[model samples]
Target chain A: MNLQVSRFQFFSIVLNFIIYSSILMAPGITVINAKQDGWLSMLLALGVGLAANFLYLMLFKKHGYPSLFELMDRSAGKWIGTALNIVIVFYALHLTAMVVRNLSNFMITDVSPYSSPYIYQILILLVVAYTSYHGVKNLFLISELFTPFISLFVIGSLIVIIKHFKIIELKPFFYNPPSAILEGAYSTLGFPFIEIMLAGAFLTYVKRKDKLVSIALSAIAIGGAVLVITVILVIGNDSAYIVARESYPTYSVMRDVSLTTTFKRVEIIIGIAWIIGLFFKISTCFCVAMMGIKHLSKSKTFRGYIVPCAILVWAMSNGLHKTFIDFTNFVSMDWTLYWFTLYSFVIITMLIGLARKRA
Target chain B: MQDWKTTMKANKTTREKIVLAIVWGFSLYYIIGYLAGIDPFPITVWLKAIYGPIYHTLFGG
Candidate 1:
């Protein structure tokens, strides 16, 4: 069966893919690193992310490959291409596991500290795996349907919290040493920004390719602007120290809003929005992993592998880190660098393919 | 050179089954071990070891 997504749906998918996970912890990570100037760091990361994406798209277009896997196959030869595909499949699965763990950790610490994270893990995996099994349309459709509400949640928080903004909180602009600001940008870069390369998996399935590069970049720009605004709001509401210390600063921002005597529980909406965001995130990664399997095995459908995929993702997520500290530590400090390994793989393959002039 | 796609097409079921068995085996080991509270083989130990030098170098812990 052929599957295709419209440009608008693809835009929504890319937007949610970037926003959901990043918004929750990125503010705290950036604030902790760049302090009050964290927004600058975030802006810097977004700028770099966009430019990298532009270059990636242009190179792949020039290479004339429908997919990165195809590019690798023609460039590196058969055995090596299969190996690269397997490595990427593992990477996507690892991402699914890590994202699930992120959700479960959030639930335990913030939503219900008394609840077992394993419960959330199982519950979420059931939905995610099932959505992934139905194939890409179902997954992307879910994201397209819910994109507006998530956007509104962000916008509504901004509107309601404007009264609380302390313009002074954004002071001492650029006070952070360039290295510190760059460090903040570097951490955020590897995450939601650079990870956009995952879009390569779905590129061939997109109905519109001519403007796809611009559409994707625009979607990312919007996502980045949201992150920057979130930092401003988060820092404006509380001191940088406090915002930095909060595990989920954007959640904290929504949780702390008090417009009236009893109308301040915007956090419920934020929580629901984040859950949907995570659903898209995990489901997208799961589907990509499945797609990689499809490409690698040359299989007709990836349906039969869904059960194992869910089981492995569950186990890997549980076994990924010993504690929440390890999880957050790796994510905050080293995730970008770890994820860069995939980029390094792609660059090597692309160079070899170009040198061979297969096109 | 055996074309990988052609090779995969010829043995798709076998290839998929091998992939499934491998995933199940690896994950089930962790699942059973973690549930039994034994964790005979912890992947984190290896992962952290690999990422340790990189993390320290990048963030300077």
Candidate 2:
């Protein structure tokens, strides 16, 4: 087990983790709450998200036992550390379920309406399981390979659609109060921003830890910038009232892009890119969850849990929400605060553990 | 080794094989039940019950 990934690969990991499911939905999620000034909310989340990234980095001690799970044990003693690990494991698994559901919902609602979501779920799950079977580095390598395609397709679509951005869509910018805008940021702050910390659980395997901070924070910056631009472009091109109503607004906005008489259907490219992103995301979460179980059980190999975890993720995805609307309701309203609360719990425990070490 | 669990392996222990079987059984119970159109309990029931009061209160019923 001499596994180690380069900072470049780690950057790809964080980059994929940051933008995954957020690329399409972030605009709609923000606009729904903050109305026309939704990009502002995204900017606000980016600022907080970067600061949270800094705080997460600070939690990684420079000395021995730099791993977060190890740090928990060193700080809080055995039981609390184990408990914290369990919390992360559950969060990772649940988040995997959520991502699986997200992709399935997108395919069902936006792509093909007649198919059962489980069909999509099982298809992705099998690949995710195979990725897990190959290990975390495989996920990282694939992220590195696929990231450019996702970014290129996404940004290219944005560039093509930029000419359509009528500043009129952003008129009456401050119509939503600060509280409403803040609510928009709050909904997404946990989703696209905080979930990057999941990479921290496994990044200790990076051989050269120097510049980890720069790599991760820059991923946050780039990911958030892409998201903010998407918000502006989509809302700028389409009405907030209308974009806010759609499940995947950016995709729909991209759907209307026409390079010429023969060159439309940009949404399909974005759709495929999204699948790649979701694949990386689901694989990463599955790996993280497997790590949590491995750490807790002191198992000889976490790869052994891959199949079990994949099946559970598939099961959980199918079982979590009865309808796509329910999933959206959870995401827009509860997703942020839920992750927000969980991060608070983990942060407080870490702080207490750090203080205990000082004493 | 920190990497042992995360690095892919080519072989599995007997215990892991057994665990896999058990997991397959557990999953089949739900997957088959769902295909048969039997969903006794969904995760949303518990999730809604827990966060129900909060988000429901804010967003309305």
Using Cα atoms, each model's DockQ against the true complex is: 0.37, 0.28
**Scored by Cα lDDT, where does model 1 land?**
0.83
Residues A154-205 of candidate 1: C-alpha lDDT, one tens digit per residue: 7887787777789798898898899889888987998888887877788777
| Candidate 1 lDDT, B1-61, residue by residue in tens | 5698688657658777777677678767767876676654665566667877877786575
Go through the candidates in order and give each one's C-alpha lDDT: 0.83, 0.80
True contacts kept of 2: 0.29
What fnat does each of the candidate structures reach?
Answer: 0.46, 0.29
Q: Candidate 1: how large is its RMSD?
A: 4.5
Q: What is the interface RMSD of each candidate, in Å?
A: 2.3, 3.1
Candidate 2 lDDT over residue span B1-61, tens digit each? 6578555343455555655565467667766665666663465676666776886666455
Please identify model 1 stretches exceeding 4 Å from their true place.
Answer: B1-12, B38-43
- At residue A74, candidate 1 shows an lDDT of 78
| TM-score of each model, in listed order | 0.92, 0.89
Model 1 alpha-carbon miss at residue B18, Å = 2.4
Clashing pairs in 1: none
